[model samples]
Target: MKLYEFERAPNPRRVRFFIAEKGIDLASIERIQIDIGGGENRAAEFRQMNPMGTVPVLELDDGTALSETMAICRYFEGNHPEPALLGQSVIEQATIEMWNRRMEFNLLLPVAMAFRHTTGHFSDRENVFPDYGSDCGQSAQRMFDFLNDHLADNDYIAGRQFSVADITAVVSIDFARVIKMRLDPDKHARLIDWHERISARPAASV
Candidate 1:
């Protein structure tokens, strides 16, 4: 198996976290670096695997390339159900997806837009222009407030058990700090505490 990854990207980090949590052997898995801003992923060679030219693509032993962070996460869940990252029951799976989607739209999307628009990280791509810097930033801040309130009662984003939803949310929250947006420790103690617990996980350092 092979993984096309980018060190500075959150999407790849999510996959790495899952692999670490699963105790998957990194030595057996080949890693190919994808230059996020250099059009390396968009090149003809890489595009044969992922038309979208995104990072964290998993190439199976059968020469199948899997894309999308959520889809890849689910694939790993199905293959390795011992840790059950996606969730064990139907309701648990649904809850995980629900929270994951919310986090992606409310937090991840905005963070990416802010980075791209403000920094012009991918200005060369015709479809990568910046138009949502202010909107994305505002929406992301609103999400922080919503998450802060929701996390007051729960230890994790989806529920009692740690699931892929927490993985997605944690990555987005951590990435937000790069844009000077984060859960205020004074204002959101519960959320801050939750993050601390998640951060302390042995897999996090991966």
Candidate 2:
């Protein structure tokens, strides 16, 4: 299998982190670098793999390509079952999925939209709407407050164990810094603690 990704990209980082957690042999999978800034993803050959022209694409040996971070992570989970990131049972899987979706929508998407719309990073390649950028940043801030409150009680985002939900949350929270949205130590002590614990994990360094 081959993974198309860009270093430092939040979405691709999610997949890299997942692969690391699963203890997958790095030698077994081929890694292809995509230069988003240089318009590499927009190229015709890359677009043929993913119409959205996005990174973190997993191309199977059969020549099938899978896009989207969570989707690619799901594929990895199914193939490498040990150290399960999703969950052991049906209920656990559902719970983890719930939290993952919540974090993706409430935190990740807003933070990304804010950066893409406000920053000059995508100005020449994509449409930039400043009005929506401001709104998205405000939305992400609200999510941070909500997550901080939730983390005050639970050690992990989904519940007791560290799951994919935690991965999604950590990546999103860290990536939000690109838009100048960050956790306030005084206001988000629990969240900060959780972040620190997760950051110390070996997979996080991947």
Candidate 3:
């Protein structure tokens, strides 16, 4: 398998972190670095593999390519199920999926939209809808508050155990920094504590 990725990109980092948690042998898989800022992902050759031209594409040995971080992670979890990042039971799996989707939509998407709309970083590369920037930032903050309250009682995003929900939350929280959305120590003590604990994990460094 070949993983085409860009270092420091939030989505790709999710896969790297997931792979690390699964104790996957990096040597067994080929790693291809794509220059996202340089628009290499937009090139025709790369676009052939993924029409969306997104990073963190996993190309299987059979020449099939998988896009989207969560889908790729699901594939990995299916093949390597011992660590069980998804969940063990039916209820647990459903809960993890619920929380994961919530984090992606309520937290991650808003933060990303805010950054893309407000910052000039991708102004030349993609369309910038500045009119929605404020709304997006506000939505992200609302989700942060929601998560902070939830974290007050629970250690992880889903519930008791660390799951893919936690991974999504951690990545979203860190990525939110680009839009200047952060966990206020006074307002989100529990969230901050959770973040600190997740950050200390070995997979986080990956």
Candidate 4:
């Protein structure tokens, strides 16, 4: 399989993190970098592969192309279940899914929206609303407060074991830097600790 991705994009980074955590062979899957900022993804040849015109599309050898970060990660997780990032059991899977979704909606989406709207990064292709972006920044702050408190008692997002939820949380928090939203050292002590711990992992660098 070959992955069409933007090197610095958060969505693609999540996939890279998942692959690294699973101990997947990097050489086995070819990585093709797409220049998203340059509008390479909007090109006709690329759009034919994925009409959505998004990066991080996994093109299988059989000519099947899979979009969406989680779907691609789920594919590999099914193929390599050794170090289960999603989970090992049904309940664990559900819990991880719950936490991952929470991070996706509450943290990731807000940060991304804030970045896109406030920075006018895609003004050429879409509308930019400063007020909406500010609201999203505030929304991300609220989620940060929730996660900081959640991490106080729980060792991980879903509990003790590290899972995809943690990956999502870490990536979202890191991405928030672009929006000037960050965890306060005093107010978000637990989250800061968690961030440091997770960042030390080898997979986090991916």
State which candidate has the highest TM-score: 4
Candidate 3's C-alpha runs over 4 A off are none
lDDT per residue for candidate 3 within 96-202, as digits (tens), equals 99999998999888888888898857787888888797789999998888988998789899999999888888998898887778789889988999999999999
Tens-place lDDT per residue, model 2, 52-118, is: 9999899999999999998999888998898999999999999999999999999889989999988
Give the per-residue lDDT digits (tens) of candidate 1, residues 73-149: 77887788879887778888788888878888878898878877766666777555455776788888888788789
lDDT of 2 at 16: 89
Q: Give the winner by lDDT: 2 or 4.
A: 4
Query: Candidate 4 residues 7-126, lDDT tens each?
Result: 788899899999999998676889999988889999999999989999899999999999999999999999999799999899999999999999999999999999999999999888
Alpha carbon RMSD to native, model 1: 1.6
Q: Kindly report which residue stretches of model 4 are placed more than 4 angstroms away from their true locations once superposed.
A: none
RMSD of 3: 1.2
TM-scores of the candidates are 0.94, 0.96, 0.96, 0.97
Compared to the true structure, candidate 1 yields what TM-score? 0.94
Q: Model 2's lDDT to the true fold?
A: 0.91
Q: lDDT scores for all predictions? A: 0.83, 0.91, 0.90, 0.92
> Clashes in model 3: which pairs?
none
Candidate 1 Cα outliers beyond 4 Å, as residue runs: 127-131
Of the pair 1 and 4, which is ahead by TM-score? 4
Worst 10 contiguous positions by lDDT, candidate 2: 21-30
Cα deviation at 38, candidate 2, in Å, is 1.2
lDDT of 3 at 48: 97
For candidate 1, the per-residue lDDT at 137 reads 80
